[model samples]
Target: MPSRGSATTAVSGLVALAIAVGVVAMLSIGVGSRFIPPDSVLSALFSPGGGFYDNVIWELRIPRTVAGLVIGAALGLSGAVMQGLTRNPIADPGILGVHAGAAFGVVVAIYVFGLLDFRAHVGFAFAGAALVSAAVWLVGSRGRDGATPVKLALAGAAISAFIGSATSLVLYADSTAFDEFRFWSVGSLAGAKADLLLAAAPFLAGGALLAFGVIRGLNALSMGADVARSLGQRVRLVRGAAALAVVLLSGTAVAAVGPIGFVGLTVPHVARALAGPDHRRVLPYSALLGPLVLLGADIVGRVVAIPSEVQVGAITAAVGAPVFIWFVRRRTVREL
Candidate 1:
């Protein structure tokens, strides 16, 4: 049970994060190569069609902004769930082979089928993530113990390494893939389209729900599996469901936006610091904070490179790495 003061603080912090998300989102829409003034940006938002900056605002920036919000929230939730599930501070979908699977799928689509369409990449990448997720569960749950944290972690690491090597080999041989696929690999919101966002909405929503559903289980598990079991938590069920959420959330995000590594890795720590160790607070905080970080980095990416924008992924890494190092030095509060 949280004290009245702490609860009040959490609610205040959440409100602040929500405001920040909105401010950054507006910046994302307005502050691009050809900057639309705030008044015009607001006007365009109020009356979207046939505007002065219709092409840039509605077509390009809006889709990208929407993608950032959805993907950032998804990655944040997935990372929080992953860290709790594995009890590893650095864990994310990458630790579960889910990300490697998506990357491999994209690599195959480019190398094998010569498909360059971003839409096509989404389907292929999602399929790969699904397959790898199932494989990880099966391998992790081998024996009567059934998906212990150590077993799951080890399984994911091994599968990720294998898939990574295969992907590297393919990229090494195919120069066309090397050139074309590298763009997606680096992660960028420039590729986001309305169709892709529509396609991903269901998956993202489902993932968010699943992540929230297991928060109690995760909080229980944080006390150790034996203790969790003693407390009537269904350990295996929680682990499986959390892993599925990671696959749905991080998998789809990677498929959609390529791999923006730092959003998931770093956001949870910030959430924990702000919201404390309780996952009910941590997960929600992370979802908001994730988009705030990603979109802010994206806004920076837009400005720093005048005519040609830097990819959001690159900017996130550049920005997030320093913040993460600071967290490590400070030993700030963390969820896992």
Candidate 2:
């Protein structure tokens, strides 16, 4: 249990992050190629009459903003849960092969089913991610140690590589699919629709619930598996639930906006720094900070290149790669 002072600080951080998310989301709506004034953006948001800017705000910006919020939260929370479960500071949702699996599914859908619609790819992506996650768990759990962090990491890496190769082969064979996949692979919130966000809502909600459910167990596990076992925590069950949550959250996010990396890999660490090691606070902080970082990245992507836009993934990579390198080089990276 966290001290009262720490809990209060965590709550305060969450509130601050929520405000940041709101500000960035508004920026996402207001700052585009044709910059709508703040007053105009507010009026359009409040009064959805038949104006051109209103259409742009309500029809275009709102959905993408919503997607950014949802996907960012999913990635952030999933990443936190993943690190907790694995006892690895750098463990991300992709470490379970969920991203690669989802990408492969999208590729296959494009080539075999002739499904080019972004909304239609959700089911295939979820299915692929779920299957790959299960396979990784099975492989990792086979040894006497029973899904140790190292084993799970190794299994996930192997499976991700295999899926990546398969995806490349399919893309190489079909130029049309490659063309479509290339854009999706890069990742952006430019074309996200309200319906697509709605389509992925249930899975995201379920995953978040599962993630919250395992927080106590995660906190216990953080003390070491032996300590956790002594404390009567069901380590295996917690790990399994965390894995499922990761698949649902990561897969749905990838399906919505393709695989936007580093949000997961980096956001949790920031949350931990803000809220202390207690996952009770860390999860919510991550949820809030994820959108803050992602929406900020999206806004930067929009502003940095005039008429032409950079993909959100590209912007995030530009920022996150250096942070990742710093993390790796740290003398004592905090493992929580």
Candidate 1: segments with Cα more than 4 A from true spot: 1-5, 333-335
* List of clashing residue pairs for candidate 2: none
Candidate 2, residues 1-336, lDDT tens digits: the string is: 866436567677778888889999999899888798898888898887966699889888889899889989998999999999898888998889898888888888899999988667778887888888888889988966577788999999999999999999999999999998888888798978988888889999999999999999889989988888899988788788988888888888887788898999888887776677888987998898888888889989988999989999999889888987786676335666
Please give the lDDT score for candidate 2: 0.87
Q: Give the TM-score of candidate 1.
A: 0.96
The number of clashing residue pairs in each candidate reads: 0, 0
* Candidate 2 accuracy as TM-score: 0.94
lDDT of every predicted structure (CA atoms): 0.89, 0.87
Q: What's the alpha carbon RMSD for model 2?
A: 2.2
> Using Cα atoms with residue i matched to residue i, what is each candidate's TM-score against the true structure?
0.96, 0.94
What's the lDDT for residue 101 in model 1?
Answer: 91
